[model samples]
Target: MPASPHPDPFTGWLRDHAAPLTHLDPEAPLDDLEPLRDLIGDARVVAIGEHSHFIDEFIRLRRRLLRFLVERCGLTVLAFEYGFSEGFPLDAWAQGQGTDDDLEGHLGETVPVGVDDPLRWIRRHNAAATRPVRFAGIDIPAAGGSLLPALTPVADYLRDIDPETLPAIEQAMRIAASFAGTSAASAAPAWARLPAADQDALTAALTRLLIRFRAVEPLYVSRGDRRDYDLALRRLEGACQADYGFRAMAGLFAGNGLTADTSARDVYMAESVLWHLERSGPGSRIVLAAHNAHIQKAPIRPARTQVPGPDRIRLQSTFLHTPGLDAFDGILHTPAATVARDLEEGKTP
Candidate 1:
């Protein structure tokens, strides 16, 4: 008889499962899934992102985590920076209050890209769960400013406004300028892009445009309607790169405006953890999906202490180094040697 392929593959291997996973180098390298596996075993709140090999690892780990929660912890929530943050009304779908068809209509209006990414997979999984996942969001508004026309209506609002009022119209001109400056870069294809000079020109123009908006200090007053703002902020909260960028900018503007709804988004990451645990029983488990930046230690020292508590959340963040990206925690350093070899051997994809 052959052996069964079980969750933990280490049973028949060497005595210690830790040897393969740990890296001695000060900068942790992700060689395999051991560290992440260990983290999932004990953690009540686990956050991770969309790393290359990580997606498969997460699917496996989620299965384990879900089983553990249903059998032992009584979990009732799978908090996502994706659905709840974007106001997908996943809980409504889970409880038979609505159908995927109902939620599908709102997905385009809510999420930045169409919701065909990993987040949709998570939502579908949660929908099949025995207990419905509760809904919670950052409850903040979109940031002020005018974005370029190429962007959606929501983005136009975030690019050019000040702290007080929702300055939608005035921002249009600024967004136009920003886009005009980067028109060439926009035309370049990712596989075989244009010259670096064109890209640099666009980048510089964008920086200048955003900087000009900051200098002006415009006030964005809300019209007593938070529906769009809340929907936008919640969806923005779970995003990486552009989504996080927009969300943080919005949060800063809201803070400056002293808006009550805006204040809710400042602690959005923490609130997500607490909200999940609360929905579950006395000892519920949760798994969060977010980017490396959202999980990184806050610049303020005291804020780092908020990682492990009943209300605290834990994160497993990963990222690749690029020209414009630095100052991120939980980095998995890719040595120059490997990258050079990949490029030299024509294995660079």
Candidate 2:
């Protein structure tokens, strides 16, 4: 037989460089993921990316990967692309402090796509594990289509810690309450319709609330528990981002310019992740679960750069650039192929 002229270029390249994925059994998922420890090395944060949220196979694969990271690699935190304000209940459920029903109820309108199975698994895992893994949500508190849920908590915290600041806190709460009637789709228009004075007052009130909290840090910390202090801070951060997001939306509608709203949300999510890392202290590893677009370390262009559309916003590029953080874009050819094969075989990957 005559020798073949050459191997196909793409197949030859893949054969030389690509690492093949191990088929994962649903009954024994982590058995196949042991090799990933070497691949992950000593990186503190392993960000697993997904191409889409609605895929059952992707969700199952992520759940298995999360189990591997937690059990084998000693990862202590599993952060999600969920609202920070709404994370407490979910965290409680994961830590075995709340019931599954409680978590589902608290998740309310902002549940992530294909989260049902994973949620049940996490609850069971936490209940059985000696040292339960913690959960952290890294998005702004817009899960309920409004920032009220986040802002209300801050106001209540202030009222408890420093009654003297209640007036200022209430002012901020009122501004946030104005958003209750607005849907996520109409937030920008509603914000744009507000009087300039109201807008300025809302901004000033939130700013002052943050400043006041900072100024009384010692008192707040001493009087309240650490969790309370942390919640207050998270609420403040969410409120500030809410304001920025509204402005960004307005800009998007008016064709003013590329607003920082999307960027700000990603930055806040990154900050939330870092905060969890800090709280967990040294020797802590985090398994961050977000969309591929939000986790990739490379510069990401807006989907439609040439056109004036919402897709043009480069959201998570800033977050990916955080120093000392290592990221892996898991939506690659090899693992995706593995997932496809598993789905075809009627097995969860």
**Which of the numbered candidates is closest to the native, going by highest TM-score?**
2
Q: What RMSD does model 2 have?
A: 7.1
Backbone Cα, N, C clashes tallied per candidate: 19, 0
List the global CA lDDT of all models: 0.38, 0.68
Report the lDDT tens digits of candidate 1 across residue range 248-283: 344454465333433333365666567546645765
The residue pairs in collision within model 2 are: none
Q: Write the per-residue lDDT of candidate 2 for residues 31-115, one digit (tens) a residue.
A: 6566577878888999887655545566767778887888888887888877787777777776677555676576555534445
Q: What is the lDDT of residue 260 in candidate 2?
A: 47
